[model samples]
Target chain A: MSDDELARKQRRRRNIAIGLGVAGFVLIVYLVTILRMQANLAAGP
Target chain B: MRHKPGMRQPVAISSMSAPDVAGPQDYFDLLKPRVMSLVVFTAAVGMVAAVADGARVPFGLALASLFAIAVGAGASGALNMWWDADIDSVMARTVGRPVPRGVVPRAEAAAFGGFLSALSVALLALSSNYVAAALLAFTIFFYLVIYSMWLKRSTPQNIVIGGAAGALPPVVAWAAVTGTAPVEAWILFAIIFLWTPPHFWALALYRDGDYARAGVPMMPNVAGRAATKRQIFAYSVVLAVAGLAPYFVGMAGPFYLAVAAALGGVFVYLAFKTLRSGDEDKASAKQLFAFSIIHLFAIFAAVLIEDLVALHV
Candidate 1:
């Protein structure tokens, strides 16, 4: 591959990593909230 | 005829790229999750204790208040990391933190911390009582302003006075249920207050070089090791006395008293060994630090268990 293509691929990989990280964090928060609510329901009167 | 030649190089070494910068997880690590867990657990115990005492706190409100306290504690951790990132980078124990590691920018950390602080306090006020909310705000202020900004760098007596931030969680939990600070709540506060110095100083004793390298004025760093050891012994004695106060005040029962007494004895023995050990072996400090966590957890756990037993029997 040309040097220009290599640079572009690297940039793409970086962006993909950043996107995945942001998505994962949001998913974790959503899951935690859901689990907490479930536990609260289980312990309810 | 002889000719002389010189070599020329690029002014900037562009090939040597900066080490891969840390990402979001690094910043999260700086918030001291282990410490935050203990704070959250103790705060929950405080809330449970209040409920067990017939304060009539709803479970939902109790949970919300606990969440708010946890967020506030996280905010304190983030803010401390933001401010101390410079020193943190120099300390072995703290060098891997997000802010220091460049995973998260300092400005972002500060903004995130401030946002959490405001959100937590506002939510607590809405979900719980204003007294609880106010105490939460004060706790954040104490940790950030009093402890982190001023006391940490200014004096060897820093943690001694600043331990109040950690000590207030139970009181905040109590106020959430009762809508007022009671004498019993303050007694619980005193137990944690006296417990903080000795527990933290033990860690400081073991990590004295880290504080010295970072230029932070920890007790062992500012005062000599001997003085720090002596203070640890003194604080342990005070903590043991304070731990028994809950029973006398009728807030806890025989179970809690027995657990507190046994744990306090061990704590004092460890502190005494830490003081007398001349081998420079930090085993006592390490043992005391680790057990101190268990000690606090057990004391609060005993409180909850005893209350449950009383209600049933």
Candidate 2:
């Protein structure tokens, strides 16, 4: 493969990694929010 | 070629050309994953210890907080790499790190670190208690601003004082679980803080040339080898004593006490061996350096096992 081709491939991989990382972060936030809400709700007003 | 703080120095380049491919792995390397692993282990032990002590935290929350803590640690590692890039290039042990090797730019490292620092702290607050988040923030700041940027280049006592940052993860983990870091958590903290000096000074003893060439003032470099040996032995003695505090404080049972005493004895003996070895001998230093890692790991593992047993049974 050409140098430019290798560079483009690397960039694509990096973007994919970033996308996955962001998705993972969002999932964690959602889970945490649900968990915290459950705990607070279980505690009552 | 001493790296003066606030002075710009050129990075020491390897004879090999910088890799044109800057991949995700290079960015991951910026996190100092090995160090992050230790942080994760110690912090997990802290969380388990808190649970054993009657702290009621959800498993999911605990897991999330641990992730944030790991990210916070990685952020600090990235910032340290950013600030120490110049000296890192000089040191044989660190010459291949991402920034120094030119796979990652220094500014990018700084930005990455800063972003992760904020993200980790904010995520921790959302996932855990404010106390844990605050401690995480302080750990990052202490490692980056206080240790990496300032004390690392300035004094021989750098590791001794800077050890606090490395030791805080467990305390932060305890706070995440309990929302309070009581004496039990502090006992864990104390064990790691004391363990730091001897562990690092042992490495410094053997790697004196790397540190000297890099112009970093490690204990062996700033103080003579004999003095550094003495200090290591002294800290080892104290560390041995501190290692027993968990049992006394009721954090662990007799099993932990037995394991801690046995490990601490060997640690002190190794430190003593390193002390008694000829000035030119690197063998003992190398042994002590390698054993110190196992020593700390075994002690914490013992505590973690005992805590798990207590929590379950």
Candidate 3:
């Protein structure tokens, strides 16, 4: 209803988006590590 | 406008000073998603072409590397926006960008760009190989430091030499997959590099006033429109030849060659039309500008499709 309220809402939404982005990055790193290990194992020692 | 008992006082919405709170979309806009999409597409085509050439790249790794490349490209876009915000604020085409519009601050853009550049390069190295990482770093540096900060203001030939940054995504992806950038990869790069001048000069022809106002030395602002048209036609001739090089080098099949040749022919024809158009007529330049986007996209898409069919079907 007001400028202050709108600003707060935007900030809250931005924080949530950032949280999700960080979580996504962590998931990607985990998946990449697993995939790389599998490839290395398939290639043999 | 009078306040009654138990009623709130009227507040003028226009006079209300809105706080500077940027949403995630503003930050995403800083990344220049359009350019990121182009980078991802061309890089994927490069990876697929390499795969077709017998370079064994796992699908997941390819996807991860592509993500890194996209982020790296976005980082460059952010940094460019950060540096060019002043000029961008005056240009009609760029005035709506995040930094220029005040949705995002320039310093924040620079920091965000710097952080993403490092993270993307590291991710590429970790997920793929060092060569890809190095190429991504170089691309970011070239776009930010060389093109945006220096050449962009100093020379009319800015986009000509600066096109290398835009052209390197495919080469980087090829190196990511094969650990070496072969001639085929450079042919892809050459196609894009040659396409840049004609593509941008056409836009400059119509937007010379915007460029002149921003004090940027776009071809039409530095050289007259006639000379810019001549250069566009000249570059279009070479681009047509470069577009067909993938076939001669055996990187693509007959279907690709046919599509490329047809698209290249039309590209040159449009450039010729633009060249012959009267000085005050921007219609031809506008048509050429619009077609150049399709020309580049279709050529790459044709190569990608042919390679994909060869690999799967």
Candidate 4:
């Protein structure tokens, strides 16, 4: 592949990695929130 | 140069060039995964000890805090490698590191480290208390800026005080659970802090040429091997005392006390052996280096087991 092609490919991979990392972080936050709410509900005052 | 027997031979790299492609493993290596694992284990032990000491934190939150602490540790490692790439390139032991070997560019490594440092600290703050996050931030700054950038090149006592960065994980972990570090947490920090000199000085005694060639003023490189050996023995004695602090302070139980005493005795024995050996005895230093890792692991493992048993009772 051409140098420009390689650069574009690298950029695409970088964007994909960033997208996945952000998504994973969001998922962790969501899971933690749900788990915490579940615990509170189970406690039932 | 004639190295002592049983030393691992470093690959003779005559030339260095950038790879055509930087793979996932290269990036992962940038994190210094082995060092990260040790940090994670010690931080986890600290967190578990805090829980045993009556700090209430949700399991999920604790897990998240541990993750962030591990990342923060890795971030420091990456930043260290990035900043030390120049010297790392010259040192035989570090010549094959990702940046020095051109698997990862210095700029990319620095940016990666910077990004991870921010992300880890922010994640910690969101998951746990701001105190833990702030401590983690300080750890990254202290390791990268203070230790790696400044003291490493300037002082023979670089690892002496710079060890504070490594020793802070337990304190940060304790603060994550309690939102404040009690004396017990600081005791754990003290054990690791005192333990650091002997642990590293042993390695430095053997790798004296690397520090000299790289222009990094390690204790052995600056103060001579005999002085470094004496200092290592001195630190080991204090470390042995600090190792018993968990039991004396009532943070750890009798089970941990017994294990700590045994391991601390062995550590002192090894350090003494390193000190008493002839200048040519790289073997003693290597033994101390190897056993120092085992001592830390066993002490922390004992603490975790004791804490778990307490919870069961």
Candidate 5:
């Protein structure tokens, strides 16, 4: 691959990685909150 | 073409050097953390105020909810900055902001804000309820679309209307806690909403030239300073009454009433002083603007403390 093509591929990969990281972080937060709230509700007052 | 023996070959170099990678702090700055802190504080107060006597959530969950509130508020700020970056660049007071200073590109700001807006609201729903989640979404929309995109450049009533979006955080928190909004929740909303005009108009009074240059229809720029001051005085009277309403309605105690009365008087007095002054009294305008911030903080602090004490006793 040419240097330009390699650079473009690297940039695209970096963006996708960043996007996935953010998505994963948000997913974990939501899961933790859901589990915690469910446990609280199950504890019954 | 043959180069001379001493001449070096010209190398192909990329014209675009590396763009500065935004650090965590830059993203945080895009959130306008200062304003977010105040919103979070008020939202916490709203939560505390909404709780029935002796009712408590799991401490960890409560903390998570507060974090969500802060993130939602920050999302609104980021969206506001993204939309206002054009005007922000022109205004002297806002020229050094991340978006305007090129620390965060406008598209990046919008995308980050959009992502946070969804993430914060969705998390809030998981932690709280759909009512609160929906309110958060509406607040974001009001701020970004109604206020920033339309009313801001078009009308002198921009801040007056835009204030609703800023004021909704506390209401959203209250709804999150109670699962249903009460009249008291809206009373908190009213205090912030009513407080907005005088607070922002005081700023407009001093920053008239900046507003004029930026072509933003701030009250003092659209109307004369005299008219703006009259409106400020009018709003100050209404705000003082609204600020003290929680105590009158039995949400706060006598001590809060006294504190509110005293500070409210000082607030009105400052606005009055600014109004009565000649055209050149930027100091008086500045004083009113400074005191207005303190007035809100003091009133809300009293409410939070009074409610917490009430809960214990």
Candidate 6:
């Protein structure tokens, strides 16, 4: 690949990695919220 | 060197660089220190009240838990600045904020928020009950995700509902010592929750143009000034009643009852003034906005003072 093409490909990969990282972070948050709500419900008044 | 027909230009690297070199004050601004101060004070009140009520929280652990809660509040502020930089840039009141001025990079703000979030929750868990730590974590998540990302852009009721996150600090502090939230703690929560709408809507009334320019769906922008004023009045009335609830519930004494009644009366009066005043001047709106802050702080201070006085008597 030409130098410019290689740089473009590298940028694409970085963007994809960032996107996946955000997705994973969001997944963890969702799981935590779900667990807390369940626990609060179980300990209900 | 022909480009594809539909290709978009890549973002310039220099454009992504921090726009202005920030001083220490910029970092302080990132915390929204005024708002954080209220969170810290109210949380501390909750902690002291819990202890006064016969909960035996160790001094060291309580101090650590308070610090963690403060950091959590700061983290939420930072994340808010990060997400709302665009809107902040356009609003006169928020134009000088660190992120909007580019004194802080958005990514750095996000990373700072994430780091503080993790540290706060971990420290809370280690020093206090896991339930408190978990509540703190959820508060951060609710403010940053639900309030900032979703509700803020989607609806005018954002502040009304999102206020729950701010209201949770006292409950979390109570749980830190007692290992559970009680009816009294939630009454405190409800007071703050109901108080938020009138407080925020007053500011929204004055900053309606800014919100409209920034495309934020603040009540005044989406629902018109008259409707927003009426809602503010309604919420102020509800908040006044809720503020008086602690005294009725036997959680507070005569001093608290007197202070709450006086403040709530003034607040409702201010709300009514704002409703009656012409939208052209905006003076009443501004007055109500300033008084709302004092109203909340004074009420909390009264609670602390009343509790101490009751103990002495």
lDDT of each: 0.79, 0.91, 0.88, 0.85, 0.81, 0.82
TM-score attained by model 3: 0.94
Tens-digit per-residue lDDT, B157-258, candidate 4: 999999999999999999988899889989989988888889889888888887777777789877888889989989998898889988887888888889
From the highest lDDT down, the ranking of the candidates is 2, 3, 4, 6, 5, 1
Kindly report which residue stretches of model 5 are placed more than 4 angstroms away from their true locations once superposed.
A1-31, A34-45, B1-19, B52-56
TM-scores for the candidates: 0.82, 0.97, 0.94, 0.89, 0.86, 0.81
lDDT score, candidate 6: 0.82
- Clash pairs, model 2 backbone: none
Model 3 chain A: lowest-lDDT 10 consecutive positions: A21-30
Candidate 5, residues B1-313, lDDT tens digits: the string is 2222432332222233334344455677878898899999999898898774333565556666778878888888888888777677767788767787775778899898999899888878877778988998999899889998888878899999999998998889887776777878888899999999999988988888887767778888778899999999999989988988997777888888998899889988988898889777689989999998999999999999888887778
DockQ for all models, in order?
0.08, 0.66, 0.73, 0.24, 0.15, 0.03
**Which segments of model 1 are wrong by more than 4 Å?**
A1-45, B1-27, B279-281
Worst 10-residue stretch by lDDT in candidate 2 chain B?
A: B10-19
Instruction: Put down candidate 1 lDDT per residue, B1-313, tens digits, no spaces.
Output: 1111321211111121333343344545655788789888888778777877887755656777787788888888998888877777777787767676665678978987898788789767766768899999999999999998888877888888999999999898889778988888888889899998988899998998887766667888778889989999999998988889889989898888899999999999999999998658388899999999989999888887887777677
Model 6 stretches astray by more than 4 angstroms = A1-45, B1-19
Docking quality tier of model 4: acceptable
Residue B304 miss distance in model 5 (angstroms): 0.8
| Docking model 5 quality class | incorrect
- Each candidate: how many clashes? 3, 0, 0, 0, 0, 0
With a 3 Å backbone cut-off (N, CA, C), the pairs that clash in candidate 6 are: none
Instruction: Tell me candidate 4's TM-score on chain B.
Output: 0.94
Q: What share of the true interface contacts does each candidate keep?
A: 0.00, 0.68, 0.76, 0.08, 0.11, 0.00
Range of the 10 consecutive residues with the lowest summed lDDT in candidate 3 chain B? B7-16
The alpha-carbon RMSD over the true interface for every model, in angstroms, is 7.8, 2.1, 1.1, 3.8, 5.1, 11.4
Q: Considering only N, C-alpha and C atoms within 3 Å, which residue pairs clash in candidate 1?
A: B22-B103, B26-B98, B27-B98
Best model number under DockQ: 3
C-alpha positional error of residue B312 in candidate 5 after TM-score superposition, expressed in Å: 2.4
